[model samples]
Target chain A: MSAAPVLCFDLGGTRMRAALLAPDGTRLAAVEAPTPAREGVGAVLDGLCALALRCRDTGVAPQAAGLCAPGPLDAPGGRMLAPPTLLGWRDVPVSALLGERLGLPVLLENDANAAAVGEQLYGAGQGAGSLVFVTVSTGIGGGVIVDGHVLRGRGGLAGEIGHMKIAEHSTDCACGAQGCFEALASGTALGWRAARVMRARKDGTPPPSGRDVIEAARRGERLARRLVAEHGRWLGRGFANLLHLYAPDVLVMGGGLANGFDLLEPAIRAEIARSAMPSYRETPLLSAALGDAAGLVGMAHIVRQSLPDLGRERKLG
Target chain B: MSAAPVLCFDLGGTRMRAALLAPDGTRLAAVEAPTPAREGVGAVLDGLCALALRCRDTGVAPQAAGLCAPGPLDAPGGRMLAPPTLLGWRDVPVSALLGERLGLPVLLENDANAAAVGEQLYGAGQGAGSLVFVTVSTGIGGGVIVDGHVLRGRGGLAGEIGHMKIAEHSTDCACGAQGCFEALASGTALGWRAARVMRARKDGTPPPSGRDVIEAARRGERLARRLVAEHGRWLGRGFANLLHLYAPDVLVMGGGLANGFDLLEPAIRAEIARSAMPSYRETPLLSAALGDAAGLVGMAHIVRQSLPDLGRERKLG
Candidate 1:
């Protein structure tokens, strides 16, 4: 008999998504709800349990669950430690709380790390021995996979590539550091740069969103194109650093900014070619294939791996 | 019965040093010879074998050998791929050639990587689960140890930290890149910067070597002190990047410039504390304990691990 499905959750500050995935990683059912982040930890935990139950009630009883959320988190200990987007939540035992409510084992992972595992196992990075997965959204975030395992360094914080200092001097990051990669190249950074440019042009237009800039560039607006190119150049600089450090089989780009990967690929490639050592220049850079589903799929795999006995019990029954 | 000793070699452009190390990593006997690098691969290989035999003849027989040399190298394939320091040599199968001569199984690793393993297993980084080892010599190079195994990324070039671009604009590196860690922070870079300063002052003093600058700084010369501080600042920036990316248990410093580690430590620590995220700020920065013997000790361990059967055979005999 085939193994039972595993429940997976991608809990973001803005939304909470849950899915029941078949053993082969097919999403059999899913549910979504707005996160009660502003309503405190108790509300958030209760809401997650409700969402998970709604997905579990879809006629396929998941044997285990996995949760992927923003960090700084203790993945091994299953605790959240002050994720920026989730206001006022601190040291919450997310895995334990949700697990007790559902009476199943729940493994926890960083969202970007889940995406990396997802891509490596089922997306653009399939068959790769090692990869670097980067997500450029409100803030740049990433995960590193080495020899098929997520490189969770001391304190499970190994893949904080977004905070890597890319320039000697530049804008400040929310982390209070100057010249961080996220500060220079994230979607938020791109929009802020575009807004500054528009303001300097003495036009009465309101500040554009990151997506607005990408859309403008798609429509052949010269200013937007220039801004996007500059964004790609910063990303290339950061990617070159990643290549030098990891030399992964591939670099998988995801997140909202990656929607403009086609527009950004040329500049990114050109800068990496110019900045990276020749040996590292040939590493493939590709767009992530799993999209929003990556975290869910990755979580499902993590759950199965962590609770193999549950899958065996289901098969035996 | 105790395990047999392993022969180890640290092959550099300037010297070839060989040693017989007891199973516990104690150096039993050693021999050194100048590398005939300019005379080409055949001459260098012959010199290495002669040195190895001399070290072996010192009353203990080694069952296998490990060699740590400058890279770009294919460590698993045991081939050197166009190392900059080794003149006129490319893709030489040094391990196969040496193993054939000595009648022993041989393992090869990049020099920095070997040092990293050595530090992690038996030196300053002893007991650390993960660490980054950096050598500041004529060039900057590094190795990453993740979960007790060296992180040899695609093509075995994972830890080329020296070539990591630290600045968006700066001096040129030998690798044809601008603003690399090596170009900014290596002993060679420090010397070059000092020489430029001296020339601009129109002083008739011949260009100072990197060692000269360090010695001058030791004596509290204001100009040399300032230069060394600048060098430390650059190293700090590069190290902050490493900390953010790897969050290693510790960072071990080695190579020629590390001799001045006491003087440089303050600036290096200041930069990292100022730049790295709070969680990573407490990682201990240490001077390499085994000194020049780190490579040999590391290679000895590698030899034992790679050829466990050899150790068993020696024990049985």
Candidate 2:
């Protein structure tokens, strides 16, 4: 591996994280700030550039950079296509703008895709020829790797697992669809279910957030436990669909909800055992290893790979 | 393109079809026979070899051969792993056995994958960079093509779309799963639904086959039309899931049921319009162009591609 480092950014709806990562994936410097999404695309882009400069000023001049953001993205074109969370950011040419401002070649990837690559190369999915990585946070998202590369279908829109409809009929998803996997099983869905149950009790207890429900379950609350189990059941159903579709070498679970994976594993496993075909029943499922750092590390590697000349030049400030 | 011909075979539970196909996918000669499934593996292999010999005698000697079969296959190893349809056969090395018998290297592929490749190369999916093909016959099976190659996940079982659990709860599938896409929307499922409705009516009429239901629907029978529409709704739900997962350039529908695609297209389209994420809503839905000849033509091209040396040799018998 080259000793040269790359700047990496993980741009999310809530926060934007930047890091200066060595070629081997060590973070030499890192910084994060709340996203100015409501202020429009220009402000968010400016903030991202400022963070990149901060990481660059840490006395280790980076050669290239990689940025991972929410999709729907035109990855090859390096444009973000109106992601729900990134308000007012429609068809923004992020990669070109960032590269032009920083004077470095930058590669843009979907956040979930970057995370999948990160886990595959340095985390739980290491050595797996193909992997399916799913992150269950406020909503669900996923990425797929096949034959050591991300499976980017037409328009680089493959691996949009959250929008997959898993139920015959149920709640509508934010994407304007009914019975979507994310609609039924996301953290938001769990909170919604909890709120409905609380409302039905007539005890005047306020509705809990998704995090609160998880914490309540961790504290041995019966209702919270049942709710979590139900969430796991939906997750397992979606997981079974992924298994059938990808038959991946490994399936990695990540994101906020995965913090309580132990509590969810039994229900998830049971549902998968009931739904997946016999041949797929033995597929290994594991929690992600790199956690929050996955996107940064993954993007760093992607940039290094995309701009091989950066490693050879090794320009020092 | 090489002028040499290749032999192709599509082996199914009910029948086995063989053809001598030119490099351009023309059928120089064709033959088929009922599969002797009850006569054991050896008999089936012998029958397959006999059919190959008959095709070889058609004055156009094939350079190589490709065979497609129902899967759960170890495709790299060229072995079939106990497909439910092919009773009494487990881990049968069809490629090696056929190659040895014919003195030609034979390539084995999953039937659905072969069909998908066929459609992409020479059928409705022509010019598409990637495609998802679903064949809703006795059961619903699928194949995915990405960047012009088959998406063969681990064990070559990636295209088992039939078993994806689409319903939260429903009747059990032959594979012992409840609410599978196949269990809810397959031709067999349609027959089951028709039978239940007929029994409820008590009009002294015998139960209708899935084909009878389709024919009745085509002839404008109310009950049969409703059944077909319901089937289409289930199909659309499954199609939406596929759209979200692959976002393929095109989606091809084939198999026996595809003969009635015109009847089903309206409902399928409506459900997709309602359920699919907007980005994927415009993916072209097409009927397979080559009909039953798709597998044969596709396998011929695959054989040509896999054994490039065969084209150079110009073996004329």
Candidate 3:
């Protein structure tokens, strides 16, 4: 591994996380800011440019930088396509703009694919020959790794797990599909289930969010516990379906909802046991080790692999 | 490639087809007979021995034999584990028994996987680096080839595509799953749908079977045509799902139902166009080039690969 430090960014619609990661995989410096999603693509690019510059000012001239951002990315061209999550952002030449502003070679990767690479290299998926990483948040997204390389599919959309339909839910998904796994098992779905199953607490607290529902269940609330279990069951069903499809060596869960993994693992396992054949049932499902920072971990390698001459380019320039 | 000829068998519940294939992928001799399934394992072995002896009499001393059978197989142990399609077939030591009877080494393979290998090598999937082959017979089974090798899942059941759930259909599948692809769109399902829509022929013939239904549609029977289209729709949905999962270089359809490819291809493409990303949509859906002879084609290679020393043994013996 190169001794040179690398800049990493995990950009999402709601937030952007930037970090300077040393060769030791330690974050030397980190910063976060709300994404200027509604302010238009130009404003968002300016924000990112400023963020990268601020990190570069930390008395360290990073050799290269990597940005892990939301998809439908035109990865080969280093462009960000219009993703519904990013509002009106479309056809932004991300790497060129940021590289020009920061004076460093930059590599752009899909966020979910980056996270999978991160997990495979430095977290729960180490030593696994094949893995599928599913992140359950407001929407469920995924990344698949096969034979030690991230599977990008033909369009670099191989891990769009959220759009895979699981069952007919009472409501349709934002994807215009009925009964998507995300519409059933995402934090968004859990919040709706929690709201319907449990009334306001006697303490007169605010409305229950998905995290509140997890907390309520952790506190041994009966309806909340059952509702969480129900969520876990759906999660397990999706896992089973994926197991049948990929037969991955490991299935790792990340994102915010995975924080409640303790309450969900059993139900998930049970449903998987029920659905998957005995041969496919052995793949372990585990929580991601890197937590919130997982998305950018792969950026280091991405920069190195895609731009091996970064240091030479900078010196010559 | 060796100049050694190999014996191959494609065994099913209804029949057993055998052939001696030369080094250049040509059939030296071939024969077919009823499976003798109702006569128990002993009779089945005896019949297979007789068939092998007859083929051997044609002056082809084969290096080894390969058998492709219905699965839920203990492939490593060379045992058949009660596939629902084959009655009374449980824990049959196929390789050992057949090898002993024929006085040659034997290798066992799942029929669909073998067919996929056949297609990948000598049929529509030729030259494709990655392929997904679906066999639509009485049921839907599949084989996935990636990086030039068949993907055998954890227990060698990786390509059981028929069991994948589609949506809630009116009936349950033989696999005890509701709305399985087989339950909704297989030839068996088409037969039932055809029976429902059309009465017995005016010539006082019995209710039309699945093949009869296809024949009627080919002749432009209105209700049969509509029912066949519905089957095509479901097939398209399954194709879309597989595209998202595999993003294979080519998709090949084999088995009896693929005979109706002219009827199903349009709808399959339409659903795929609607559901798959543009890049994945480019993968061609083509009929398997080998037709009904595909199952045993891969067996020749399987025998060669698994028993590489068979030639030496034959010479020494």
CAPRI rating of model 1: medium
Error of 2 at A199 (Å): 2.3
DockQ agreement of candidate 2 with the native complex: 0.77
Let me know the TM-score candidate 1 reaches against the reference structure: 0.95
Model 2 misplaced regions, further than 4 Å: A1-3, A308-317, B1-4, B308-317
Cα lDDT tens digits for candidate 2, B1-317? 44688888899988999999987787888999999988888888888888988897887777788889988788778788887787788889988888788887778888888899899999999999999999888888898999988899988889689988888766789889888889888888888899998999888888877888899999999999999999899889899889888889999999888877999999999999998888888899999998888888888877777775544443542
For candidate 3, write residues B59-165 as lDDT tens digits: 97987888888887877667888877666788889888888788887788889888888898889999987788998878888888776777775566666777666
**Best model per lDDT:** 1
How much is B57 displaced in model 3, in angstroms? 4.0
Per-residue CA lDDT of candidate 1, range B147-262, in tens? 99999889898989998888876677989988899999999998999999999999899998788899999999999999999989999989988988988999999999988898
TM agreement with the true structure for every prediction: 0.95, 0.94, 0.86
Error of 3 at B242 (Å): 1.1
